[model samples]
Target: MIPDPSAPAPTVRRKPLLAVLLAPLFMALIAVSVINVALTAIGEGLGADSSGLQWVLSGYALAFGVLLVPAGRIGDATGRRRMLIIGIGIFTLGSLLSGLAPNVEVLNISRILQGVGSGLLNPQSVGLIQQHFRGQARARAFAALATTVAVATAVGPVIGGLLIQLLGPELGWRWMFLMNVPIGIAAIIGAFKLIPDDRVRTRTRPDLDPVGAGLLTLAILGIMLPFLERGASVLVWLSLPAGLIVLGLWWAWEQRYKRAGRPPMVDTAIFSQQAFRNGIVIISVYFLGATSIWIIVPLFLQMHLGHTALEASLMGLPSSIAAAFSSQLGGRHVLRLGRKMVIVGFGIAFVGLLCTTILAGFVDAGWVAFWWLAVPLTLMGLSQGLTISPNQTLTLNSVDPRFGGVAGGILQLGQRTGAAVGTAMIPGIIFSLTEGGHSWLEAFTIAMVIIMALTLVAMGVAFADRARETSAPGAL
Candidate 1:
């Protein structure tokens, strides 16, 4: 039910009150990008080696990705608002535990708990937007969501660096986790008071789809472990293929469940839309390249150039500022141009990565020309801000209201899975190049080449397809 482009936008009755519902999602989004800047500090403080450090980073996405679909189903069938509150509670507890963690292993576990909480709260954000808004107003709300996410991604490094500087490396990272406490408390209170109970508005008693949940969890765990767990081992190599097999089984099982008239973890029918499917593909592929910058750029600045966390992060400010501006202003094209904005977004990001590859390949590590980086970083932020929100707008436009939570969960699953894969695989490539006695600059450059290659391939996929324009409504 997408409105005609010429139609006037619908009105949101209580738009100002949305900040409360957006708070937890906003904080969680920031946490995803912020942790990358903390990696060097965390490894040194915990005495973690390369593999251990990778786990410290990827483990959160591991748990977060694995639980998303199940959480979406739970939110859909049960109560989205209640789940959002419970998720805030869980995330707050996880943050406290992470701050207090004495060992890397404990830190990883705490992150998993935080991931679970994040997964639970995330889908509700989408569901609530659908519940309260319609037509053009809904599109604007989604854009606003995108703007918030872009802001998080942009400033994540700065926030992480500031915390690390203020608290000192060994202790600053802990405060990063701890800072979520007060924010989560406020978000919880706001959610309780401001977000209406959409669950009670609907009579559909959504039974928890446990079997589907189990299968999806197992499938994601199998896929992720091989990447997260390093070393050339038989089990590590085998897990990916085995995970693929589990996914095939999961799909088959889901189809059967749908036929049997039971609540399925995913509505298999939703995948039929070319726009939605392609949007997911674009999201995952784009993030694989884009998210890598947050992790690897910081590593390059700190390790290769001998910059402190704060000094290194300052280099990223141009990108963050660009992203914030684009999310609010540049993203307006989605309503007029539809999915074409995504194509333009990809084009800019592709160029940004190309610039990055060339710089990492040719630029001297000790060169004081740090300002050269500002150009590509700004491009990257602009690309992300333009790409993320519009792609989301197109993807959800066609989904049925009843599956909004599930679709939202799948959206996170795609992005996090991309982040987790890129974080795991790309860094491994960089480490391997260094392990072979290559200079740090040479190693990082080689990794950048690979990322650029993949982005090109993703663009080819997008060029062949055009997304349709549509609008979806709320079920509860």
Candidate 2:
């Protein structure tokens, strides 16, 4: 039953609706970071070992990454608000289960369910933004989301530390998950009041490609399983080749399915556009460098520099503040400057990384490290501010708005994949450098080398943005 074309479009008050929609997205970001601080506490409480701890993180990420595309499609077909409410409900329930979990296995299971909730809601936020806003207003909405995510990340450890200190591990860890309860409730209530109910009506049944979903899930698991199990057993090696084969088969199957007039797990056509393709590469590389800092700096400060969690979190303040402000600015300039923002941002970030390497090498005292690290971190934040929001704007703007849900899913998948790889690789780099009785300086140097290499790649892609702009309409 098609809706009447003559019916008037529903009036949606943009600001209030956006605020309501973004609330859940903000809560989701908080959930991710809050757990990072509570990981050790949760592991100890559940009697989990190193592998179990890794599972607690990777399991959620893996589930979240794999399901994002399908969830986005579901929101597009139905109503985004409906999916948001359901997803938030599931997420809140999962958080409760996680807080009450009696064992490592239960906690891990709960984390995966929470990830499912995240996957469902993540794309809906993007879809709703695309549906409701256009041009500058849309850019602002995305910028706000990015800033919220950055701030939440920066505050996570501090909040976790204070909670753990004040309440102790058992109760404190629960608060991390429990914090979502009220936030989620507020989001649900606001969503009902603010979000419009004007969904695209359809009589034809939308075919969900379960086989493709299963294959994609298997492919991601195959790739991620080895990293999660590294240093554990010989089985890790065996999983690698099998995962590669499964992934190859999945890609081929998707192409075949697309030819048969079915919506495959991912839309292959999006990659055909040079701008979209280049945007993905730049995003992956930029995230690789940025995520490495988060993964390595915290561990380095806590283990070698002898700083507490709170202190380390405080040290990250410079970058967080810079990034939040820069993102808004970047959104404003992206339409005018085109891809110049990417080049400028990466250039600044590269210099900051160099300064950071020097500071880490020369500084011995904790206070000295803090002050010196702040300079580079602030640079990084500025660079991030310039790059991320514009990149998102470019990537989304390059695509047809009809495919916004899928595009957002793919973009987010790149981010998670980059983060997982960056997080996994940094520890390996540190471990490898320290093998020959080398000083911490050697490890820091190697990490900086990797970051610089990623920066150069991002710079190269940014330069190529000119060709992409010419080839595509509205690419800037």
Candidate 3:
């Protein structure tokens, strides 16, 4: 039977609703995370050098980041479920293409398709939660999402490594991509079955800003491409400046779009909301730290500690599990403590980071003594669990549901931007600092210090954002 078009939006049962909405997101995370572990196999198989391998990763990130706002905006206008199904289909096809790609170059193109699909689908997860749930239910929904993503991030490497070890690199990597086909199909089926039809009646006519969207997309490319490029070249230096220029033009066009009563890619007015601005600062900085450890630690483990991919992945598992638990606890208590939860979450995470950094930097612990790292990582995960859901809840809570898609898109944009920057710069710092007879320990230590600092800044920002205290902490 068809979902009743006239029924209220949140008519579906909550758990099933979340399961359907979050499945694609879970697969997207797995898709990217798994690739990192499989990159070596891919490189050797395709005869790819460093640059080709880098593109395999960067291509997906660039496309995914660039298209997020446009995808979200389109979803908000046309219908989120409609857009999501299309995205899932594209993602599945991308996986098929990736698995089939005989060469590295074709693999890069397939990665872009996967990224685009992710970009299209991710915002809907957040927006739909905002759209369907209210008050305490909303917080719980976000918490569930946070934990699911954390677990997915944590498990991706281990699962990928085992697949490679058991199946052989050539075939294992291909199976990783092929794995998504079944998951994506199931998610599509569940989406049709569980997700309710849009029924809020949009606040305004659906006037999409194609010009603004194009400008925004190009602007992202301008900024992101430079980071993705390696080597010191004139073009490398020019990428950031060129991207900035495009952004300025996009802003100018946005003003015109607003005045003309068209939907700008992101309404400039969203920035005016104090909670939104504060949340942006908090999440972006947090990601700078959060994403860095994930990338750098595995490299450290596999190379410096001389551990296999599976070993490194196992070392990280406790943290993900901790984070999953903490996320639920944070959500359960958010209504009780309100903004203090965010503060406490960051504080806990800060301590965790400090411990992890000291242990890694000073002790120079290796794979044999994995518990030393595991202790701090678990703490860090818990901190993230506490921080992400509450902060996300507070951020989107303030914005009206009409712009929910845009708000979620921008929030995710900030995260992707931070992750991209961390992945590009921090690893480079490790390599650069480690060169010229510097020890890996010293290089990693310095990176850890920098990584710790980002989280510290985020903690400060979260503490400073007192506006959430005054608002309904659990506003419907």
Candidate 4:
């Protein structure tokens, strides 16, 4: 029953294609922020500490970050359809495990499994978009992704909170992970039916470059472990230098591997593209600051102010909604406005964070502060809509379609890595300060300063990139 390789590919309808692609993305993106509202309940249910709860988030992100490049490369070399289906299956299983986990240790492991699954499928989606669409259509498709991200970020807390409220905290939190089961199952079926077979034809076997992948994985693990562990053991610090050394070796090996007429896990040459490089830096830094806001704010509302999970989640609801609409608008204008849109977006986001910090410092009344916070969150959402998708469009515009999977994987790696560090580091700072007798508001204010600083760093990078594009014209 071998199928003809030369048969004309079936026409892919746009809406179905988008639905299937975005569904999995929605699941993964929601996982990133949704759990913030549930962490307290999880800790109370499982008898875990701050560090254990942190691991639940950090472990997922770490596994997600490390697997991204290799999964992207493998998807490109193999069949993306198959890889995507497999990823969803794994993610679904992880969700089930997470729901059923008897203890914190098991929950962390299950979350890592979920991360691995997300890492596998995400690149494939990007590569598929790169392969199937061109020009404005491509921009719109990416906009769809950004919109999905926005909604997921916006609704995750609400959903988590609502579940906790309806079912009670203990049972509510478990359902958050469990809910993905049916959705993931549906996505896998839709993928098989709707996605066109897009395996590249090759005369020779695909080179997966396992050696290079191994080296890169070790390097990433070394670099990220210390940040996640947050000095739980002093020896973890040594891994930083060691990871850097391995990273250098991985780069050198990539050069040698390419010179030997084989594909490397990442084509080192991709980094030479200015737009892609700059986009990586900007997004990574942006995520470092941006992702923490969701985590810290929810925790502050719940733990410090004694707000309910549902109430804490509501704080960011307006922002998420704003982002969703703004993302669509940004997608339409991205090609026309270019990096200027991204720069402006970063500027607005920074202002939002700064303003939020000010309100937290001066306002002592809880309900009143929540109402006041909405304005800044809305501004932040608007900025997010402008920044994320537009930056993605600009960044990947130069990447070769053939390498789109790895390129997208690299792009998301920056995001996930930043998220991991930020989720761990920012909360770690606040928790540490609280332990040291600082008020939650004071600790939160200091963390906001750090987040704002990251936003500024991203803005600076965006400005520099804009300058590069202006000076060289075609440099990006």
Candidate 5:
């Protein structure tokens, strides 16, 4: 067979593309985790109470979650490159505001701005990878992303702790935000040059469906508000039902718009795709189970067990390292093994969780128990690397690249929602159990079981999806 000389060469340069895309992501993730270690300094510096400190975290989360789907829709309709640059710019400005904040209120508002910026760019990154990369390259790209997530999650505390120790509390926390300024500027410049502006223009204008967007905004705010403001007001629970109602209305409007031959904010039909649907289930459930470990473990080690903040962070570093390594390996293999990789990942994670629970339950609380916990935590991290990137690859494979931004947005929204619910419920369970006279280990054991149960649910979904693919031969 003769190769066609006229065919255009593959223009996608994987490494440069990934670097440009992942830089903003690294900055965003670090902001999320690093703030935990700096909360005390921030409160003291700003004269904030527990409630104000909570807002600094919650405001970021809320703004981040709310903007995801809308930003994705806009990016899909417009040019992703443009959106990515704008998002990074906004994030940089927010970081500047946060670093120089004179009051808790200003700091909380700046954090929300940062969240909005992160929310805007995240889907564009995923979409660009989907649009440019194919086959194994796509898997590797996602793996790289998973590695960034692992490294950022693991090192955030260490970086925060080191800064605070060397520079003292007042200036250290300020530097955490300020550090992103140069990085964000560089990323924005790279994004302008490296990110291809390849959005295909059509004669028919794309409809953004503002009405649908409005409904979704209401629904998301309603559903997420209760979780964010957990103890604020009993009236906050009303938002849950209100959110549900708005969600139903949004569904109806989307269906109606699609029937009328207009583009809805989200095409209701995407949910019908088995791969996309099941992938969302697995990722969301996995996040629900896995993300809480970073929260509860630190609390158990530092607040209850009286370890130094940096010491507690170091205990989790091994797991993060394992995750960072395995994610790249998992990316290489995901194309061959498919959903089996995720199933195996879940199985290993369950075992790790079981081991963690048993060890914590049996071993007395001290450095010894902490050391034992590291072994299982590393296993869990390895499992995570296998699960996350592979699941993302499998899920988005079915969607057309044109809708990649919207699809990625929706997928991340599910993940964020799951994390919110899980973090709220799982941590609350430990606190509630301990307050009710349960030992710290006992509380941790119960929470671990819940996490295991969530992981099992995700595994079950993966198995069912695998069986469906086998039975139908091309259903996925």
Candidate 6:
């Protein structure tokens, strides 16, 4: 039988292809923050504490961070689209398991599985964008992607709140995970039909660095476990030293592996580019401020102001909307304005956060408080929108395409690691400061100071980037 030459190749128009490719990853971003409002309900339902709550959130982040480098490598070795499908499927399964989990331990385990899935898929999403799009198309796609992320981050809390309110505690929390089912299915279908397969040249089977993976995983776990178990003095003490030792060893092993011409968990050479190194630090600090806002703001609304979860989620709308719009705008100006966007972004975010800190002290059920919080949150969102996409583009652009996967993975690791640290530490800061004091206002002020201080540090990094850019071979 002759092969049918007339058969149509799968017709994926550019627009649909963008949607098909971006939607699942966008949903994944939504999943990251959706659980924030649900934490209390999840804890109550699963018989958890503050520590367990931290585990539920940080476990996914830590797992995702640890596995990102390897997962990116796998996508490169195999196929980006193929691995993405598999990863999304795994993530869907993990989400279901998490929703149905009978206890805190099971929920934490499920979250880790979800993180693994995120680890596998997250890098592929960015890789596909790099592979498939270029120039203006790439810029537009990134803007859209950023908007999706902003929307997801903004809407997740409200959706979770609604689900919790409508369905009540028992069934409501499950919907958070269950909600992924339809979205995941659509993404899978879209992948098979719409996403074009992009594979890299391979000469031999890529060697999996199991030892390095193990060490990295353990190191992250050690570092995160202490923060998760904030109230447990013994666990915190043990994890701190142990995490440091493992990290030191991992660094040593990576250096040795590089010398031996083996694939290190993270290629140290990327650090050679001043822009890439500084970009990663900036990304880290940006996430620290952003994630801390997400964590602390909701807690303040729910606990101090006695707002419902729904109300808290609603309070986040202004910021989310602003971020969605600003990300695209930032992309446009990146080429013209250069890296100064980073400084501009942080400066705006600093002012916003400072305003929020002040407003938080005087919060009440009125438009005054709402506007006060809304304005800053909106500016913060705008700042993030402006800073994040450009910083990511700059980081990846500065590196070789061959090592794009690893570099992207490292950037994402920095982001999630910062998030894990921020979420874990902020609560402890609030708790410690409020131990003997009944003034929630006092506690919030102190926390805001710490957060603002971090933002200032990030701003300094951005300024350093501009200085470095000026001194380099390229000139205005």
Q: Of the candidates shown, which would achieve the greatest TM-score relative to the real structure?
A: 5
Clashing pairs in 3: none
Clashing pairs in 1: 2-471
Query: Which candidate wins on lDDT?
Result: 5
RMSD of every prediction: 4.7, 2.5, 3.0, 2.9, 3.5, 4.4
Ten contiguous residues minimizing lDDT sum, candidate 2 = 1-10
**Model 5: runs farther than 4 Å from truth?**
1-10, 199-205, 362-369, 473-476
- Model 6 misplacement above 4 A: 1-14, 43-54, 102-105, 199-203, 364-367, 473-476
| Candidate 2 wrongly placed segments (more than 4 Å) | 1-10, 198-200, 230-234, 365-369, 470-474
Model 5 C-alpha lDDT per residue in residues 35-85, reported as the tens digit of each score? 989999998888999999998999999999988888888888877888899
Which lDDT tens digits does candidate 4 get at residues 31-104? 87789778889999999998888789778877888898999898877767788899999999999999999999
lDDT over C-alpha atoms for residue 47 of model 4 = 96
Each model's lDDT comes to 0.76, 0.78, 0.83, 0.87, 0.88, 0.77
Model 5 poorest 10 in a row by lDDT: 1-10
Q: Candidate 4: where is the Cα deviation over 4 Å? A: 1-10, 44-52, 201-204, 365-367, 434-439, 472-476
Error of 1 at 116 (Å): 0.9
Candidate 1's TM-score reads 0.89
lDDT of 6 by residue, 1-476 (tens): 32221121244366787787678777787778788778878878878888788778777877777778777767755567788898889888888898889999998999888888888888887776666665556666777887888899888878888888899987888899988878888889989888765544457766656677788778877876665554658846698789889988988888888899887766777788888889899988867756877777767777777767677677778888998888898777765666787788888888898888877766643446544677778888888887888787766767665555667787888887787678777767887777877477788788888889998998899888888777863621
TM-score of each: 0.89, 0.93, 0.93, 0.93, 0.96, 0.90
Worst lDDT run of 10 residues, candidate 4, spans: 1-10
Better-scoring candidate (lDDT), 2 or 3: 3
